[model samples]
Structures are given as C-alpha cells and as structure tokens.
Target: MSTLDTSALVIGVDFGTDSCRSLIVDTITGEQVASAVEFYPRWKAGMYCDPDRNVFRQHPQDYIDAFTLAVRNALAGVSDEVRANVRAMSIDTTGSTSVAVDRAGTPLALTEPFRDNPNAMFVLWKDHTAVREADEINTLARNWGGVDFTRYVGGVYSAEWFWANMLHVLRVDPAVRASVYSWVEHCDWMPALLTGTTAPDVMKRSRCAAGHKAMWHESFDGLPGEAFLVRLDPLLAGMRERLYRDTYTADTAAGTLTPQWADTLGLTTDVVVGVGAFDAHMGAVGAGIRPYSLVKVMGTSTCDILMAPAAEVDGRIVKGICGQVEGSVISGMTGMEAGQSAFGDVYAWFRQLLAWPLALLGDTPDAQSQRDGILHRILPELERQAALESPVDTGMVAIDWLNGRRTPFADQTLRGALFGLTLGSDAPKIYRALIEATAFGARAIVERFREEGIRIDEVIAVGGVAKKSPLNMQIVANVFGLDIRVAKSDQAVALGAAMFAAVAAGLHDSVESAQRHMGSGFETTYTPDPEATAIYDRLYRQYREYGALIERLSAAEAHPAPHSTELCTPN
Candidate 1:
C-alpha cells in the first residue's frame, strides 16, 4: 500500500458509552490513521438499568481503557519515522457523564444506595434519575424567563443539564455530596488528567462542554450568578470555585499529556491534549457540517442538531434547548444543540422484547403471537414493522418521550404515551407510533429553531441510525416537514475529533478550511411530504393536547397511572 507523508500526526480519542475509539489523524492531509475501538466487557451488567427504559451508564476506567486501546492500535499502524512527527492528542467524550472524585482524584468504590443508583455512579446523559429535579428547574427557569442564568439554556433546564444533575446529587445524597470534592465529567476532566492538571493546574474547561453541558459562559460571569445556585440548593453556593472559565474550542491545546498518562496510553509524553467536549458537537465537524447546519448524532439516543451564528436571537428562543453559546461549535458562532433522548433506545427495546421474523408477522398478528424483539429478525424490528405499514394508516400516535424529551421541552419527568390504541392494535401499530413520536419530537425542535430565528438553512444527518434506516429518515422528513442531508461518514464523531487534532497540531488553519478538505460528504436526501405533513400536523395537535392533559393530571395526582405506550410490555 502506498503511504501518505503527513506534516503532523495527532490522535483524537472518542469516548462512547460502550467504549472509547481512538483515531490517528494526519493533520496535513486530513486523513485517518489506523483507528482502534475498545469495548467495555462490564457493560452488559452495569450499562442497562432496564432494557425497556432507556437507562445507561459507563465507568470512567472504561473510558481510559477505550483511549488506551485506540491510541495503541493507531500507533501500531504508524511507521517509526511518522511516530516522531506526532504532536497534539485530544479526546471528545459524552458530557454530563460525571463521577465523584476525592482530593486525590480517584472515584471511590461506589457505596450503597448509589452503587446501582444511576444518579450516584456516572449519571449517563440518558440517565433519568433527576427527573424530579429537572421538572423543578424547568418550572423555575420558565417562571423567571431565565433572567437569572437559564436564558442561555433555551428558557428551561432539564435534569440532564449540568446544574440540575449537580443539584440533584446534593439534595438526594448528602454523603455523596460531602465526599465528592470535585464533580467532574470525563469529557472535560479527562483532558485535565492527561495534562497532569487537577483543580489547581487545570480547572480550565472546554468551551463546548461548559457551554452545552455545564452552562459556562464567557460573557456573563461564567454560569449564571451564585444567586441561582443558592435558590436551587443553598449548599451549591460554594461550587463557584469548581466551575472554570470557558476555554476556546476543543482544537486548542489544554496542555501536554502527562508522563504517567502518556506511558499508560503507550504514547509519547509530548502529545498535546485538547480540552475535552461532547461527542455530538465533534460529530458535526467530523461529518464536515457547517454552523447554521444541524448534524444529528443518532445512536442509542438521537442527539438532534448543533449550529452556530454570529448574533443571538431576540428575546428567548425555545423552551428546552440545551444552549446557544459563542465558540461552542467553531469560534465566533453560537452553537445550538437539541436531541431526541430515546429514539435508538426505543427501537432497541422493541427488538429485545419482540423477536419474531418479519415474514411470519406479516401485516396482521394474532393475540397469541404478540412479542417484542424476539419476534423479529430485523436489526430494528420497529423499522421493519413500520416499513410494512401503509403510508400512514396505523391508528397509533405516540409521545416520543419514552426516555423523555431532550429538546423543545427538556422534561425528564415526562413519560411516553400511545393514544388511539385499540384491541386491533399490534406490534406494528406500536412500532409506527414510536417512529411518529420521534418525528414529532424533531418537528418540535425545528419549530423552536425557526421561532428563535436560528435560520436552519440546511440539515446534514449522520450516525448509524441515519444510514441503516431509511424509513426513519422518511418519517423524520414527514414529521419535521423538512428534507435532511445524510452524512456519508458512519463514524462522524471520531472523524470530527481527528479534524480537531489536525487544527491543534497546526495542520489546519481553521475548522472551516479543514471541513472543506477533510470533511466527509453526504448521500441521498429525504424531502418532507406536504400531505403527510398535514396529517402529522393534525396528529401533533392531538399529541400536544394529550401531553398537556397528562402533565396537568400527573401534577394533580399523587401517583397517576403510567402513560399509554409500553415498550417492554409483553406481547
């Protein structure tokens, strides 16, 4: 094989829930060196709180393991000569995936009440333990018009956001609150660790992570005034020291990799580590997406889109958007992101519970033969089932908040609902409902963006979900009422991180230039159907009424019955 001589060699490590993947990047050419993926063996036991519920988490050590394997594998592909030219190293990780570290920066062996507790361990982004807190934050933020600080966070907050989860811990588990000196996430903290910097050395933060997850703002005194904290939890007033000033984009070097970490990852100590950030943002860049252009990181959960603009929208924008921050995506633009927290998980759960061959199920199923994933042989039984249905004849409409809404209305307390279910309903009815729910969710976000005047000129889709399932895209097109561009790169997040490594190593002058040359292209596009759009418009109105009624009733009742839709419900 002919080899390409690159000016700079850098590594971009992407830490996912299952494992960490390292990509070796040629800064000059914007090419991927031999990349490596490491999976977590312990994932089976700890990762799933319930297959039906979209519950998940990952150990920090698993992250380190992923990084180690990815780096070593990349180096194995490098020639002895190119190895010497290697410069900076960096990592992109899932945000708000946090752990309690001691003064020495070690995560204590998880204690009782929290070991299995999703909140205490590493509350994965999809984790919903703080649903109650999220609801409260939403109420308060909406009450205040976000004047205090939440204005940056789309007028409302969710339990998944940094502040809500942090406050949830302090109120729920006082002991954990006390022992935890530093509440840090691997996305940001891992870079700090690699650089041999702790709170003192590098209390520094990633602008992307802080702006999106931690609510860090360079403009107004970094993450709302302390008054908001005191209002949430009087104890939180002291946490100002832990929060850091938002650093530049992830391409900027946070510091040099420390000797110990370098040795552990089998890399040279000279490697540069950039401030860590969420995988979704990097995926946008990796897919070669531009700001004002939205990129979807669709995997187990569908993180909807990210964009940046020069000026902020007037007044407030949407209800539950994560954030609109300067330099969050690329420098000098407001990076905006929102997500559908349960798409993939919902599909996965359907398959696991119903395992039937598609041919056997046909359009109709007897009551005796109803099962979830076990009944279907397709990768996603939901998609397969939905694809077989007539354009839109299934008498099922669902609220796609099974794992709760991630954008538009970031309420974790919200649950999934299936309306118009009758005895005639089958697995396909429920399956189609799930698809429509996600489509409606997307519409909610798109509408929110337009309302804010973000001017979502174009949309580029990436991720395993976008490639594997065409029906999902069609549903999304019909649902959101917009055509979306699918990313050609299957591994867009890893590619995005590599792009950053190139920039930090001086291979690329800026991200936009890198995106032009190195960015992956796209395939087919799915345009919205106006007929389906009109039908969906009527359905969405019903979905809104049903959701508002449920929310009001749930608020009134001490323990209202569960929502109509059931994921793992037996056939």
Candidate 2:
C-alpha cells in the first residue's frame, strides 16, 4: 500500500446510455470538486440504432471522444492543484455492453475496415436483439448433461447479457466474427484502455461484469467449459480459450495511467486506474449501501443492487435475479442484482407517444424551438398533473414491460400492455397508470427477494428519476409499503467509482473505510402513505394477475401447441 494523501483527488467517469460524465472528488472529505458531462455525438444523433428491432450499437469513438472531453472539461473548472494532485481514477459503465475486439483488444468498430459497420460496434446493454440466442442458452443450460452455468445467475440467461449478445452477432455477421479475437465488456475495456493494457490476454476483466453477465464463477473455474460452448454452437467452440478465465474486483488497481492518457486527461502517469464494474454495483456503494439494503439505480432503467454477507448467502441461489457475485459490490460481501428493464424509459416512451405532433411542426427554427420546449416540459408537467389524479379512481392497470421484464424472471419477448382504458381516460390518467405500473414492477422485485429469504432492511433510490420526480418516488414507496431514501449525490454512480479509486490508490485501506470518510448521505426519505398503500396493494394484485396472463399469452403465441384450435373456441 502507498502512503495516504488526504488532499488527493480522484476521477470517476461513468459511461451511461446516452452520455459520459466525469466527477472529481476529494479523497478524504468526499466533497465533489468539479464535474462535466458530454453526450455521445453519434448516439445522440440516433446513429446505428433501430428501436423497432431492439438493435442499438454505439461506436467506440463516441466513448473515447465523450470521456476525453468530459474529463478535460471537468478539470478545466478546477485549479491546477486539483489536477496535479489527482491520484487515481475509476470507471463504471452499463454492463453487458460489449464489443468484439482484435488481438490487441481494439474494438472492431475502431478498425478501418469495420469503422462504419454497426455490427462491429459496442452492443448497448438494453439491446434485445439476442432473444433467440438467450433462449437457446437457457435451454441448453437446463438440459445439458453438465454444469449449469446459469445456476448462479438465477437459473435464467437474459438477452441483455454478454454471451447472448456475442452469439447473436456471430451468427448474424460473418465479417465481425472473422476479425474478432475476443469480446470485452464496456466496463472492462475502459480501464484497460486508460492503463495501456488493452491486449486481449493482459487486460483485467471485471469480476462484476464477468460473474454476473458472463457466468465466470470460481467454482466453474472461470467461464463455462469449452464443451458447453461447442455444444451450444460450433462458432463458440474455441471462444472459451479466447475469453478470460480470471476476474478482478473494482477495489483492485488495473494499472497506472499511461503517459498518453495522462496527457490526454491532464493527469500524471502516477495516477492509478482501478478495475471497472457495472454502474449499478458501484452506485450501490455511492448510495451508502449496507448489508440487507436494496439500492435502486433509477435512470433510463432501474438496476437494483443488494449486498449480503457471503457466509449468510453462501449456498443460497436466489432464483430469478441478474446474478449473485461475491465481492462485486463491497469487497467481501455477496452482491445480488435485479432490475426492471424499463422504468424511466416507460415514461419517456409515453411522452414520445404524446409528442408525436411535434414531428409535424419541423424544419423551421421557431417550430424546432417550440418543439424542444414542449418536449422538455412534458415529463415534469405529466408528473405534476398525474400526482393530482386519484390513484384508485383512474381504474387503469398497465404492465411495465415496454422494454421487457428484467427481474423475478428475465424475459425479453414480453411487450408492454394496458388494460381497463376507456374513452374517458385522459393523458394524466394514463400517465398516472404508467407510474403505478413501474411502482408495481419494483414491488415485484422486492417480493422476489423476500420469497428467496434475502432480508431487505432498507431501500435507497439513486439516479435521475429518483432525484427529479417526487411523485414517482412516493408512488414507489406506497407500492412497496416501505420507506425509500434518495441518495444525496446526484452523481452517485460516479461517486462510487471514486470510492473504488481511493482504495485502489491506497488513499484508503478498504472500500468501507473510504465510504465512511467520503459518503454523501441521504437527501430525503419517502414514506409510504397508508391510504395510498392500501389502494396500491389492491392494484398490485391485479398488476401481477395481468402480468401472468400476458406472459402466458406471449409464450403461447411464441410456441403454440401443434393442433391448437383452442384459441378459436371459448373455454
């Protein structure tokens, strides 16, 4: 360990769905010094995406460009003292956002031949184009006469994960497959890139991403066996050897920054870069997560993280979560993940649906400005108006599967549905229904943990929706019948990364120690309203009943019985 520098600052860069943000914080006080954000130009322009097909890809140059500008801009607002004294940095990214790479660990999208190819770019975590591959993986895991790799990942593999996305790309694009040497998660790649250790064999992979999304468990001796891969697909025959066998937690240092990166980010080569992890895992740490507490990272989607003592959860596998990986959150605790695939996204979709008229008033500058103003105000206005509506009087129930369900079962094929809507149902009423639907979805996750014997003593909320929407938070609290605390830091995910950086740089002995010295406490607590809770409880039962019916109908439609004239006949 190195000497502690109480004055030292650390940088935490969070690569999110739409943009990248950099936060600089004091190592000892945890005071946020400066911050900057840069939206990915390409992504913001809606390049390389087809929402109808659930295909989303981001160019690696977008990450490189965005983070570089964000960090430099963040540093520009601070003194040279802050810049020179920065001792370390760490990163968190949307997980299962991976891309094919060459032997040198250069993303294929960065190479000249594949520079413009969407297939060679980084697959965003929310992309669900790999549903078929995920189903195949799940089926093989269950029936294969060997180790069940997905057993630790809640007995289900999701289309949003590493293997499914990789397999999907390989099967669809021969050019990417031919040039690819291995695949690397976005979280793993950033640190490796900064530390100048981008070689496929040398880069340190994230235990959080690998364990949760890629099924890399110590008991499995790393990834699943070569036999399993070969059985799953001939294309994956030798992939196990190409991919990693070992993983490191975020508390460890990946390496020191290289001179080029140091110059690029206005830092010195002495600054250490810690191993990266998924945004939600690190966000939990930033939110002051403790054992038996659930931290919800609410943004475009919601990723719920809960850490427990390893000994208590040793042989227990919670059936339908993202995964349970040891040391993924706290250094010595077991981290379990669960989430709704759509939370804020559902609201965004509804807003878009309402704003369709804006598309017609286009091209003119005045029209454009008016359109932008309306778009900006739509959500806030909806939240306010919806808050005024009576929850029980709406008599509308909605299923929050607009982007598919992510927890209590990882099913992506299911679509969002609304019921009991009449002509009298207005925008505010429908919007209120959507909010309740998301809340109900969250309650389902909390109930799943309880059913599995995992005790959740408290709930913490962090992210855009949590901070901006009191109505959403209150509804969630009522739905769960539990109080919810909002984390104080607006940049909790980035702050969590800084905590890891502090430990990796030896400014702190462990993550817990760093957190105690630097944590931003809760800003507000939302308590369940008794009357609202009672109404929500009744609506929640209906939500579950409706969700089950939707799931059954979806499954039956996907794989109907051979001679099924049953649909034509009444029961």
Candidate 3:
C-alpha cells in the first residue's frame, strides 16, 4: 500500500530495567521519525523492590505492556502510509534479564510476591543477591584466569550477570527451579511472542546475549561444558542443557511476526524480528562504532563498555583475562563489555534524602516559584553554584559501589562509602562526592582494560546520566583523562535495536553495514581538562583507600569469626 522505497521505516523497541521505549526510524537515513516511551510506575520510582537492599526484578508482562504502549504511540504520530511501509521490528533489552513462563508462554512472576521476592522474579542485570555463587565461579575459574567466555566479558564475571542469577536460582529454590519449564531473555522472547516461537526454534537468540550471557559460542558445540556447570551447581548442569540453543548474530533475521501479533499491533505480521541483544551492546552499534570502538551505556547504573576488535588477542584469554568468542558484537570482529556498578541510582538515592522543605535546607526559598522551588531542581543549581564556589568546595569524593562493584572486582557485598566528610557536609557536597565516585569507578575499569593490552580509544557515553547531567559528564572526562563520545540521539538503545531490525530485514547486508548506512547522528566529544585531571588523580588514591576500608568492614561482617581489619583487593 505504501510506495516509499528508500524511506522505509522500522520499529525498534528498547526494554530497559524500568521501562520500555519504541522508535520509528527512517531505514535509509537512519533518522528517527517518531518515538514513545512508557514507564512501569510499579517498576519505576523504586516502588516494587524488596524492603531489604537488593536490585529490582521485573515481570515480563511489564515489558509487554510497555511494548504495546510504545508501539501504539509510535504509530499514532505517523501517517497511515508511513505505518504501512514499516518493513520490520527489532528489540534490545538488558542482558540475560529473563523470566519463568508457563506452558502458554505467559510470565509467571508478574502477578504475585515474585515481583519483590528475591528468588521469584527475573533476577535483574544489576541484581547482587547471587554474589556468593559468583565468587565460587570466580574461584573455580581462577586457575584458567577466567572462563573462555570471559573474552566477551572483561576477563571477569560478576554476580550481576546471567550465569550468577541462573546459579542462584538453582541453589536457593532447587524444587521450584525444576518447575520452571522455560527460561528466555526478555529481548529474545519479546520477538518470539510477536511471532509465536519457543527458545529452541521459534526466534533467533542474540549472539551477544547468547555469547556474553548464556555462554553460547561461534565455534563450540554449545555452552562451555556440562562438567563446569556441574561444578558450579548440579542444577546448572541441567539448566545449561535446557537453555543451550543455536545462537544468531545481531543482523540475522530471527523470525517474522505472527498473524495474531500483527492483528493486535495493527500492522503486517510479516514484520521481521532480529535476534535481540543487551541494550548497551546494541547502543554501541546504533552509535556507529567502528572496529575496537567503545560504547558506554550510562544510566542509574552504568554498563561501561563494549567494543569490536580488529584481531584476536592470541594470549589475551590465556593471560588470565576474561573473553568470549570472536564476532561477539558483529559477525567479523569480537565484542567486549564492562561497567560501573552504580550511576543514576546514586543520584536518585541522594534526591530522596535531600528533597525536603525550605526548612530542611536551613535557608528560605526567596521569591522563587514552586515550579523551581523543589530540591530536585534546586540541587542542580546548587551544584553549579558550588562547582564555581571553589575548586575544592566540591572536595568530597566517594566510591560508587553503593550497590557493590559490578566489575573489575565483581564484589556485590561491598557497599558504598563517602570520604572526606566534614561537619560542613550538606546535600550538594555529598552529591558531588557521589558523582566523583562514579567517575573514579569508570576510570578504574578503563585502567584495568588498558593494563591488560585492551585499548579503549574513545568512551561513548549514552543513557539518562550522560543525556541529562553536564556536570557528571565533565567529571567523567576529567576522571578518565580522555574525551567521551556522546550519542546525538537520546534513545540510543532503541535506535540500536531498530538497526538490528534493518539488518534482519535485508535492508542492509550486515549490522556493520546497517550501522554505517542507517545509524543516526554525529558524536559529541568531551576532552578532559589537564588541571582537573591532576587534582582528581590525587583524590582518586584517597577514594581507593576509602573504598578499601569499607570493603574490609563488609568482609568482617560476612566472616566475623577470624577476620582481621586488613583491606582486601582482588587477585
């Protein structure tokens, strides 16, 4: 019905930890024509989490609601002709983020205590409750330096990743675990739902998720080995076998949408679904990363880095570094991922504590409208005022492991800490300290990567933090002593997913070709200032010391019987 040839549109959906977004992008120019974002309020504003401290898990239905809402809104703004021309739909979501489903393919965790229950829901990518099992994996893999899969990950694994949650489920709920008939990544399953398929043959599983999270391979039969999984947990032995399936790259056509899904969505069911992937990795592709280029997904939490390299580091994995198979990001080259444990979540925590009445600030709001009167708005203004107040006024620094370190060390039990606090400390000082801490966390990961011969040439920053906070971006540049590549598009993840769809539909021959042809926008780079860098270097040492002290305290709490006060660093 539509006659546009080069201007064909594609719907790319991003399934985030708290919400889902849909975007309509011009296939040839890669320009986003229209967009819609839907937030799960129960999932948002931190409402549905456990009373105790752990990350939030989402119901797959939440993503479904978001998918339908975002799709309708995206179409609502387009002309009927434009809608009809859309050739395909693709999706990206947080990696290894999954759910248990009944025979009918409905998410079982959505309705009950499972949403807040530690064991019942999808163990989110940032969740840390499974650290004990993760540590064992680390210990078991120590002899090999890390798993062969570590090549895709950064020669290190964390409890927050897919394997950690899978093992955790097996250990804690052994009985209920067997009742779990199926386990599918939210991004992988989303398209299957649209097309009516199962894990085995229904839709293509992303090589990014399959390689990075599920331990699938470009070269192997499937998974690492049943023996290794049995060592981690006996149940994981069976779990790995069940989840093992043929993996597909980002550009592969997963399946066509089913007639039922087409009727419900009010578009042709022939829409293509590319194999889905982790939001951040796809964010890199959407940003048009060249070989060995790094894309950092910045948000409440940060998935710091992913890249495609030119050559295989022959001894890279052998040097006790973590790596995954070749062509993890794209088909021709390998992709690697790493990140800071906390970013926006730290700021959200501070806002909750500081956003009180004027009496709370001990200063009156003079003549200001209530619209600009709240601490939420006032805090940014104060941070600006204080940054200019004195170079040392934003003097406090902290380590951002508030939710524990997701990488470099991979310790989840390690908590947050604020150093250099004084009687003069207030909301602004503490907030800036938190910002500096996350910047340092990024630097640590960057430093570690470069230390092991992995070159991170450009830091591509995307997500809520990078888009909204200039101060945070400035600090990040200063801390890393490197310029950052910022996405011109706000919805990098959604755009990335759509790029996959374009590849799947044969609009482009491969993801790499699609990235060049259809990926949107130029990058904005922030170079680090030398003066700021010098000051941060000294402050970073103290920040490390402060983090080490707290980690010792946490270690003591966990193993109180024979622990000393010495700080422990990773091997």
The top-ranked prediction according to lDDT is 2
lDDT of 1 by residue, 111-212 (tens): 443454444556678766677776666666556544546667766676776766777767877777777766776677777778877563255667876777
lDDT-based ranking: 2, 3, 1
In candidate 2, which residue pairs clash?
none
TM-score of each: 0.86, 0.98, 0.89
The lDDT, on a scale of 0 to 1, for candidate 2 is: 0.93
What is candidate 2's lDDT per residue for 129-155, written digit by digit as tens? 999999999999999989999999999
CA error at residue 329 for candidate 2, angstroms: 0.6
lDDT of candidate 3 over 82-143, digit per residue (tens): 98889998888886676665445545565464545545566677777777777777667656
| Candidate 3 C-alpha RMSD relative to the actual structure | 4.3
Ranked by lDDT, the better of candidates 1 and 3 is: 3
Which 10 residues in a row give candidate 2 its minimum summed lDDT? 562-571
Best candidate (score: TM-score): 2
Per-candidate Cα lDDT values, in order, are 0.70, 0.93, 0.72
- After superposing candidate 1, which stretches have Cα over 4 Å from the reference? 1-5, 47-57, 109-120, 136-147, 312-318, 355-376, 380-382, 529-531, 558-571
Model 3 residue runs over 4 Å out of place are 1-4, 45-48, 102-106, 110-120, 143-152, 199-203, 218-220, 318-325, 356-375, 389-391, 560-571
